[model samples]
Target: MIWQLDLIILVLVIVCAIAAINVKDLLSAAILLGAYSFLLCLLWAIMGAVDVAFTEATVGAGVSTVFCVSAVFHTTRRTTD
Candidate 1:
């Protein structure tokens, strides 16, 4: 059961990571990155690292995403590359 949950979270993390990179919209990419972080936190929790998971969930999903979105808001969403 636990292994299955871990696998699901892992898959979700991977999918979110790919989506974050492939999405054309900067805001959507940032949101997907946050979702990836949240999935990573779930994976960490299942691995028995509660403290690390909590930190990742809070900082990665919350603070980092906020900063990224704010940057996107201040600048243009289109990328040259």
Candidate 2:
């Protein structure tokens, strides 16, 4: 059961990653990136790395997502490439 949960988390993380890259909207992509980080944090927690999971959840999901959104706000939403 634990292994199944881990596998599910891993799959979710991968799906989020792919969606983040494939999405054309910058805000959506940033949000998906945050989701990916959260899934990773869950995986880390399952692996018994509490400290790392906490860091990933807080820094990756919180700080990094905020930074990315702020950056998008400061710049144009449309991408040239």
Candidate 3:
């Protein structure tokens, strides 16, 4: 494995994780988390753990991101009636 590429991806993962936490918009945070998961999946694939990578891509990036966005979409502001 190329150490340089691994380092780059690792940096991106850290950045994404921090950005997701700090982002104010829920949708943006969800997208950042999804990107973070996908980068992790790439790292797993590069390390020859294809099965783990596939699972991360499908469940972490795919399902979880979708669930977050869906939940955000269904949220509504309350009004004092």
Candidate 4:
């Protein structure tokens, strides 16, 4: 695995995480978190951690994101700040 590629992925993951935190919309933040998980999964795969990557894909990206969205659906989307 190329360190340059790993660095790129790390940068992307950081960016997505920050974006997810800063975004006021709950659904959008959840989606961004999913994207961050996806990039982390890719990084793990490239580092030869296939099992960990699969877990991230399924649990982090799939289940958690879905749960977040569902929770958002049941809550108000208004931004008070």
Candidate 5:
């Protein structure tokens, strides 16, 4: 509920989002996106949206991250970037 905490979480979320977008490695990007969603889940929980936070944690941060990492591993091509 504290404004300071909310602001910190918001900053972290923004940084993670930006880092994910900028990173060339697929695995790193996936991890960053997972961190970003988890941060959003924290923000939601702080705002008293427990259900939304749970869904974000389970689907956004959890399943999607796993899928992304698996897909990255399955790719035979390496980053040319």
Candidate 6:
């Protein structure tokens, strides 16, 4: 049962990571990255590493994502040819 949940979360993390890299829109990529970070935090929490999970949730998913989105907002969303 627990392994199934871990597998699902792992798959989602991989998908988010791939989407984050392939996304054309900066905002979308930033959001995907945040999702990936959140999934990682969840994975850590599930693995019983509360300290790491909290740090990743606060730093990776929270602060880093906010910074990325802010940068995206201030700059161009589209990539130049």
Which digits, one per residue and each the tens of the lDDT, describe model 4 over residues 1-81? 889999999999999999988888878888999999999999999999999999999998899999988988999665543
Candidate 6 stretches greater than 4 Å from native: none
Candidate 1 lDDT: 0.89
Task: Give TM per candidate.
Answer: 0.92, 0.93, 0.89, 0.93, 0.91, 0.92
Q: Which digits, one per residue and each the tens of the lDDT, describe model 3 over residues 23-74?
A: 7787788799999999999999988899999999999899999998888789
- Residue 58 of model 4 has an lDDT of 98
Residues 9-78, model 2: lDDT tens digits: 9889899999999888888888999999999999999999999999998998999999999999998678
Question: lDDT of all the models against the reference?
Answer: 0.89, 0.90, 0.89, 0.91, 0.91, 0.92
Of the two candidates 3 and 4, the one with more favorable lDDT, higher being better, is: 4
lDDT (10s digit) by residue, model 6, range 1-81: 278889999999999989898988889999999999999999998899999999999998999999999999998899642
Candidate 3, residue 28: CA error in Å?
A: 0.5
**Candidate 2 weakest lDDT stretch, 10 residues:** 72-81
Sort by lDDT, best first: 6, 4, 5, 2, 1, 3
The C-alpha stretches of model 1 lying farther than 4 A from their native spots are none
Backbone clashes, candidate 2: 0
What is the C-alpha lDDT profile of model 5 across 12-54, one tens digit per residue?
Answer: 9999999988887888888999999999999999999999999
**lDDT of model 5 at residue 28?**
89
On lDDT, the stronger of 3 and 5 is: 5
Native-vs-model 2 lDDT?
0.90
